[model samples]
Target: VLEEIGIIFRDDAEALALWKEAGADVKGERVHFPKGLCRSLLKTAPSIYTQHARNPDRSVQIGGNATVFAPVYGPPFVRDLDGNRRYATIEDFQNFVKLAYMAPSIHHSGGTVCEPVDVPVNKRHLDMIYAHIRYSDKPFMGSVTAPERAEDTVAMAKLVFGDDFVENNTVLTSLINANSPMVFDETMLGALKVYSRHNQACIVTPFILAGAMSPVTVAGTLTQVLAEVLAGASFTQLIRPGAPVLFGTFASSISMQSGAPTFGTPEPSLVSYGAAQLARRLGLPFRTGGSLCASKIPDAQAAYESANTLNSTILAGTNFVLHSAGWLEGGLASCYEKFMMDIDQLGMQQKFCEGVDLSENGQAMDAIRQVGPGSHYLGCDHTQANFQTAFYRSNIADNNSYEQWLAEGEKTAPQRANELARRWLESYEAPHLDPAIDEALKEFIAKKKGSMPDAFT
Candidate 1:
């Protein structure tokens, strides 16, 4: 339906021309980016604001790392918003998101989830993301993986939390049931059921990589995406349809040249757009953005790729735009610089989305009449009173003269971002968990571990 509407992965010559017109540096499947691509693309994005409140504190939030999203500098095992306690770090350029929040992502090593949480806390640079309840602008989503094997899921669970966390959090096995495909074993089914019983908010996904897991063409990718969504939804519905599950649409467009995962290439972006449409069809939220692949530091490439994918997806309205912060290398390694830059990018989005208020009489228009068009709105009363309320800010946004910028130290966005992250870390104090309850929770995990000594090994 979305395709018929002419607003999804457009890969034909015509589409290529369109992307190029949007300032994309297209080379076949690759999309080289130009500055301001995201801001520009968002103008065409097909989503509408869901809601708003008059109160400043009222907000909508979405998508995060269950572990790596945590604050690293806080006291060990700080409880996050989702009720999971874990680590957070700032010293490393790569941050550990909160536990289980980010769909299981591939590490640069092609092994290990994003965090090293299972390892001792002191040595691990783990991070946990805490989320207070809120709505989010990103409405489409794509979950990362849908492994059928029981052992793989059990292993995955252990890596995030200990053996006990599974029972305590009720994050059932990611594996499928015994009556189902052998690919999905009984253990996985049991675990998923357990998670469902608790009504966990998760996006189940059976990942299909083109030229690797599925076919290389768009049709093959679509078929695989459909199958994954079917499997995920089927399982969720049976387990608990009201579990706030989203359709899985995160697919990687593999590099035919290096067989490496491509980032911000038209291939992956296309795949993401495709996934978004499908999820919309299911009327389910999709989780599909964590795309930051340029190796360049807070340079042009990073901005271009991140902004293009972000603006495109936002325009497309993927339910849970993730990796909103701290990501790099095709969404493999988390980069603080990239995360910082993306925050600025989001701020810019906020600026763009400040819906126009066409109130007639006394104010905006009256002020306009008072100033008479181009005489300069900069020095007017209406302008001074509301300029700060109307502008987005960025250190790297090129808003000042070179000489004035030099006078202000000409700092890059990353510098300001790093300082911000550091400041946040320093000023932050972990939310207090009931000490005795926390201890008992730890003891419960220990006892569960004791029940199966062999499970640890």
Candidate 2:
């Protein structure tokens, strides 16, 4: 279908020509790839790549059986402790950044965790990048809203990692979504051009919400996703061969009755599994699946749906998991309670991914012998040595008996999560940065903001 019907490369003659010169059949704005061409171009892509963080210990390896978790992206509203859903402000964004930094399981400080609507559209990217740089030492994403914003991200990154280091290393990875049903918009393509030229990484994802952006059937959606990502990845390689990139899919289904987008469904899981297999075949890092749900709040529906998606992501062997936490109401709101709940669940998922240990120590034969067949092993030497680290413990879950629970406030999981969120913010301390570099970053942002009039859109 990609060759026969072709895909649209909207308003990007350079990309269209690049595809044509690289063996794709160009018909006006649409470029059709010949059989095996995409696979051949993808052969140069690295199976795994390192994304460096300011704190060297925090750097992450993407692909090759590794799974990295990042928080939610592109939500505009936030649900606070008082259960009020309102437009997210800079303060809300900073708070989310602090929470993400405090969470040990979350490895990447994701871009646009919630859009700061109060900030001017043109300048919010600066604040977002600053938050990630100052508040956390983890690897982060760059802006893709515009080509200029992407350049700004690179400039800001230069201050953090030095210009020479930024040019030589992959310090930032960004999301470059394809307009579904075989279209690549100018804004996204422009951002892709900037990032790929700078040797920064891009996640070429097809934002497919089934029965809307794509066909209702899993097979049909999967085919479209593959074709879309192939084209985007091919474009990245065209800009700079060997530039780091990820084959990404953000597929979800829609409700038949309400026309509402549904997540954590069976179809998305199937697509995620198939997408991972395809990505591995193409020799590129894969990114997909998350703690996705359509729940309005952090309730039973949210927990069940989030668990389903999280498990599917691990089983699919996803490399970089975006929207790993704090997604609610079809990506409209970021909930504090859900963020904490997802972090706790992330700890469990990490344990699950560790698999089983068959070593002699893991067998615990000595402990069994010491306890004997009929005796308890609770006080055995092995148990005593390993009890503290043997199993995964949730920081927010209640373990008290019914009487003890009643004696204390009868707090639910959400309530506990809310308390933990508050504590994280209260205890957060910004990571230190070199004084000269910090001043340079501030100067850069101020200069850029001064040059442009406030753009609210």
Candidate 3:
């Protein structure tokens, strides 16, 4: 269907020209890929690649068995610690960056944890990119809202990583979402071109809400997903062969009754599983799934839904998991408590991915022998030795007895998470950026901001 019907490259002449030059059939803005063209082009895209962080210890491997968890992306509203929901500001954005940085289980500092509405729409990208650079040393993403914003992200990165390093290494992994139903608009295409030309990673994602943006059936949705991803990821190779790209998909089922999007459903999980296999067949990194929920608050409904989605994500062998933490209200709001709760689960997921242990200590032969049949192993030497590291302790859960819980004011999980978020932010410290590089970044941002009038829209 892709080869015959073709995908529309709406209003992107440069993209159309490139497609035409690459032997694709270009009719106005629609480009048709030959049956095997996309697959052949994908050969240059590396099956696995490392994304370098400013702090070398925090760098992450993007493919293979590794699964890197990132916080939520593109939420405009924030459910604050005080339980009030409002438009996110740069301060709120920085706070979430700090929380993500402090989260040991969160491997990547996600892009736009929440949209900073207080910052000018035209200039917020600078603040967002800088927040990741200054507040966290983890691998981070770049702007894809506009080509110029993407350029600014690259420029800021060059200041820290050096121009030569930026040109050669995979330092940034930006998201480029397809405008679904088989369309790639100019905004996304331009950003993909800029990032690919510089040898940075771009996750070519097709955002699909089943029954709306895509077919309702999982098999049908997966077909559209593979076609969109093949076309987009292969295009990166066309821009600059060997530029890293991931086969990304964001899927959710919509309520057939009201058309509202739903999360943590079986159909989306099935779509994720199928998409992961398709990505592997193409030898590209797979990106999908998240701790997604549709609940307005961090309640029981949120917990159940997020757990289902997060489990599916890890089981799918996803290479990069976006929205792994802090998502709430169907991706409309980023709740502080939910962010804390999600990371608590992420810690457990990380341990779960390690699989069963067969070592001498893991087998616990000593503990078993010391406590024969009816006796407990609570005070055994082996138990004492390994107790601390034996289990994944959750920071959010109140596992104490009912009496103890009541004595402690009957605090709920969200209450505990709220406290944790506050403590993390209060104790947050900025990562060390060289004074010269910091100054250069500030100058670049200032100059760029001065060049354009502030546009809120």
C-alpha root-mean-square deviation, each candidate: 14.5, 1.0, 0.9
What are the lDDT scores of the predictions, listed in order? 0.43, 0.91, 0.94
Candidate numbers sorted by lDDT from highest down: 3, 2, 1
Which tens-of-lDDT digit does each residue in 22-116 have in candidate 3?
Answer: 89999888889888999999999999999999999999999988999999999999999999999999999999999999999999998999999
Q: Higher lDDT: candidate 1 or 2?
A: 2
- Model 3: runs farther than 4 Å from truth? none
Q: What would the per-residue lDDT of candidate 2 be over residues 279-302, giving only the tens digit for each residue?
A: 998889999989999999999999
Lowest-lDDT window of 10 residues in candidate 3?
A: 425-434
Task: Write down the lDDT that model 3 would get.
Answer: 0.94
Is 1 or 3 the stronger prediction by lDDT? 3
Model 3 Cα shift for residue 102 (angstroms): 0.5
Candidate 2 lDDT score at position 361: 84
For candidate 1, report its TM-score: 0.61
Estimated TM-score for each candidate: 0.61, 0.98, 0.99
Model 2 stretches with alpha carbons more than 4 Å out: none
Residue 424 lDDT in candidate 3: 89
Runs off by more than 4 Å, candidate 1 = 1-113, 117-191, 294-296, 360-363, 395-398, 407-410, 432-457
RMSD of 1: 14.5
